[model samples]
Target chain A: MALLSIADALKSAIAEEMRRDPLVFCLGEDVDIPGGMGGAFTVTKGLGEEFGYERVLNTPISEIMLAGVCVGSAMMGMRPVADLQYGDFLFCMMDQLVNQAAKMCYMSGGKVHVPMVMRAPCGASNRGAQHAQSLEGFFTHVPGLKVICPSTAYDAKGLMKQAIRDDNPVLVFEHKLLYGGKRKEKDAISTIGEVPEEDYTIEFGKAAVRREGKDITIVANLLMNYKALEAAQILEQEGISCEVIDPRTLVPFDYETVVNSLKKTGRLMIVHEDNYNCGWGAQLGSWIAENQIFLLDAPIVRVATYDTPIPFSPVLENYVIPSKERIVEEARKLMKV
Target chain B: MSKLPEKERMLGMYRQMYLIRKYEERIYYLFLEGIMPGTIHQSTGQEACAVGMLYDLRKDDYMASTHRPAGHDLAKGVTLTSMMCEMFGKEDGCCRGKGGAMHTGDMEVGALVANAIVGGNMPISAGVALAFKMMKKDNVIVCFFGDGATNEGAFHESLNAAAIWKLPVIYVCENNLYSATTSIALTCNKPNPAADRAIAYDIPAEVVDGNDVLKVNEAATRAIARARTGEGPTVIELKTYRHGGHSRNDACQYRPKEEEKAWFDRDPVKNFRSYLLSQKLVAEEELQTIEKSIESDVDQAVEYAQNAPFPQIESALTDVYWEGK
Candidate 1:
């Protein structure tokens, strides 16, 4: 086992996939340069040196072309892992991602498959509204696309490998705060984890029980998963047992695990950095209410960021995004209910 | 004057153009009779542009088409029966009844599923070309779009990327003069938008009379050769006109009568046939036989589509993702 950061884990995953299959390649802005930060966060750093420029392609700052290239290449039997400098830039290529890549298989009557992975670095950093939004909610809503958010180095490496091998378009939303790169965020959490050296893949729709308990089940992902764990620790001190569930993949959601956890805890709460209205948590809450309403002893609670765009100011940003205190408070409220 | 292709190749182009013309005519009549289920963006008059550009492409060479894709798909060798079945929304369709008229294509024949979004295929074609280039393959991709697509950001981005990477792609703009009723004059300020813009990307560009199959074929030959030799992309603007309206119900009242009449006078299929006869490359009896055969083929396709079954209701739930190999 080697201790790797999220960025290194993703890099290792891509490198291994490229070595395994000649059809696998990567494209993005600043993806490969002699002295550049391999992509914005260095996930693809040093890959060009090993694989040459043909595999690690550096493209112009064109998100539309980046996404279009992935869709087109993937359709032609080439596995392309496209990267966006920021998750918010995915909006620029919405036509390619949502309309083309997502619908190509369905539109082609399953004859064509876009086996590609789009990596978007998400979460609220110091960057203003345009750059700092956790946009997983928007992509999770899109059909014909698989969405995965990896919080740990282990999950990032495994899920990325699975994404590359999968014969469908998968969007991997990596939290900027959890990348654990050289350029650290002010509030970045400790995301270093021991990743196995051997080839391994984590299947989608499997939620990990980070801290199992009996009082309340708090379902979260990305950076919020760590926050939920922090809240669980705090609640443990107060004699309130809380179980934290990290749903690795959002589209193929592990509702079974959440339901099983709710069966044990008898209460459920979802925490996410995405905005409150129509966020992924909203779907999870609604699903639990519709299917497992009788199992719930209290109303399903969702702790998420405010609906407004993420602000630049640290104070305003902290106020909007969900924090450990908020998760703890929401979990306490659910316990009271 | 451009050097003409061999008699056999010339006749083949004429045959393909004739097939496209007849196919569109049959589809129009089928829609009129309420036999066809979906609407069509017909390529009634731009048959030569499709045939001349796509006839020489190998089976593995990719072609990204526009909403009006029947001409391109037929020319790219997508079976007429599959296209007709697709039009009928039957299970035996090329897209298995999922893609309607606007999205008709067969990847087996190297036709990427037709893109309905304006200029959506431009970047995709570049990417396909990028793949061929990365694989070190000499195969080229032909991207077909309208004059209006030249103004989209995707077109510029795609062209720039193709130019920089030296990807093997041909950007064929069938300048039908209108973006669904809005004249190209209103949207574009340049006389030849695609050709003129190709200069900005440092790529070679050409303007051809789309009604003249020979001229289109000549230009496509040079462009395809350049792409095959790693000379990067070429933007070819084929000046043509559509005989029918943009969609099923469009009367094309926005077009001027003199303009319409002038374009109709140079109908690609009719003029190409005349060229073939005048050049003595194909005898009148032989041309007539080819036309009759195409008509019978269309008739058989229509019959097959009418008899083919619709997909099961549960099949809609599948194909969202590739199940597996």
Candidate 2:
């Protein structure tokens, strides 16, 4: 096992996938430019040198083209991993992602398949509203696409390789704060973990119990997973045990683990960076309400970013986004029930 | 100077064009009688554009089409039964009744399920071309769109990428001169909406009489050859007109009588019939025999679709995510 950052883990996964399959290639703005950043967050750094320009392509700053090209190429039996500079840029290719890529298979009566992956870096690191936003909530509602958020280096490499191999379109959402803090970006959460040197793949729709507890169950993803764990620690001092669950894949949600955990805890608190109304948490909460209403000790409590566009000011942004205190506070209230 | 393909090729093109015209005519009546499930964006007058552009494409070569896909799908070799069944929302349809008139295709025949959005197919077609280039295959994609699609960002973005990467795609825009209720002249600054915009992408462009199969085929051959040779993409604007409205509801009241009359006189199927006879390519009886076969074929297809069963409701849950290759 070697200590690897999320960026390094993703880059290694991409390099390995390309080596294994000649059909796999990477394309995005500044993705493969020599001496360039190798995508906005450097997840594809140095891949061009290994894969060559044919596989590691540099695209013009056209998000729609990036997404559409991936969909088209994938339909014709090519695996394209597209990189979106910022999660916000995904909105530019909304039609391609939501309509073209998602519906092609069903619309064609299973005659076609799009084996593609889109990497989106999300979360507020003071880049203001446009650049920073956990856009996963918007995509979870889209039926055809798979949404995965890996909070750990081990999960990052494994899930990325698995996503590349998946026959359908998958959106891999990486958090800005959890990009391993190696870059000069201010306040990036420095996270590095032991990733296996050998090839491996983690199954999707499985929840990772980050912190096991019996008092209350807390579910989170991306940066919020770490935040929830931190919140758990703070609550631990008060003898209020909390179980933190990191749902790696949002689309094929792992309800079994959450529901089982809810059975033991009898209380649920959903935490996320996406805004409050109609977020992914809301759907999960609604589903839990419909099916597991009797299992809940109290109504499902959601600790999410306030229902507003992310603000530019650091104070405003921090206030808008969910914090450790918010999670702890929400969990405390759920425990009161 | 005008040249002609061999008699066999000429008749084949004529047959396909006639098939498209007849198929659409049948659908128009079905729609009027409320026999069909949904609205249709029929390809009535633009038969030659589809036939000419797709005549040379192989089964491995793809065709990306738009809302008006019947003509392109038939030209690209999608079966009549599958298309008819799809229109009737039958389980045996190309898309298992999921894709109605606007989204019928058979990928095995290299006809993609049509895109209903105005300019949605542009980037997708470019991606298909990119795949061809990446795989080192000579197979090209003939992407079809309308004049209205020219103004979309997907068109500009996909064209730019195709130009830079030299993707093997022939972009055929059937310039039927209307985007829904709006005329192309009102929407676009240039008269040639698609061909004129090719200059911005630095790609080759051609404008041909869409009603004349020979002219459209000549231009298509050049562009298709260029794409197959890895020379890059070409944008060919075929000047044509839809004999009907933009969709099922519109009566095409927006188009002037003179404009409609002018395009109707140059009807592709009729003019091609004349050209074949004038050139002695086929006997008048031979042409009549082909038309008879097409009418009967369409009639049989309608009957087959009307009798076909609906897909099981639970089947809708499938194909949302393909489990395998």
What CA root-mean-square deviation does each model show from the true structure? 1.6, 1.6
Residue-level lDDT of model 2, residues A14-121, one tens digit each, is 999999999999999999688778788888888888889989889999999999999999998999999988989999999999999999999988888889999999
- Model 1 error, position B9 (Å): 1.7
Specify the CAPRI tier of model 2. Answer: high
Model 1 chain A lowest lDDT segment of ten: A328-337
Encode model 1's per-residue lDDT on B1-325: one tens digit a residue.
1244588788888889988999999999999999888788999999989998987888989999999999999999999999999999899999999999988888889999999999999999988998898888899999999999989999999999999999999999999999998999998889998999999999999999998887898899999999999989999999999999999999999999999999999988888888878988889999999899989999999999999999998999999889875
**Ten contiguous residues minimizing lDDT sum, candidate 2 chain B:** B1-10
Clashes of each: 0, 0
Candidate 2 on B51-111: residue-level lDDT in tens? 8888877788999899999999999899999999999888999999998889999988999
**If scored against the real structure, what TM-score would every candidate get?**
0.98, 0.98
| Clash pairs, model 2 backbone | none
Q: Which residue runs does candidate 2 get wrong by more than 4 Å?
A: B1-5
Cα miss at A332, model 2 (Å)?
Answer: 2.4
Candidate 1 reference-contact recovery: 0.73
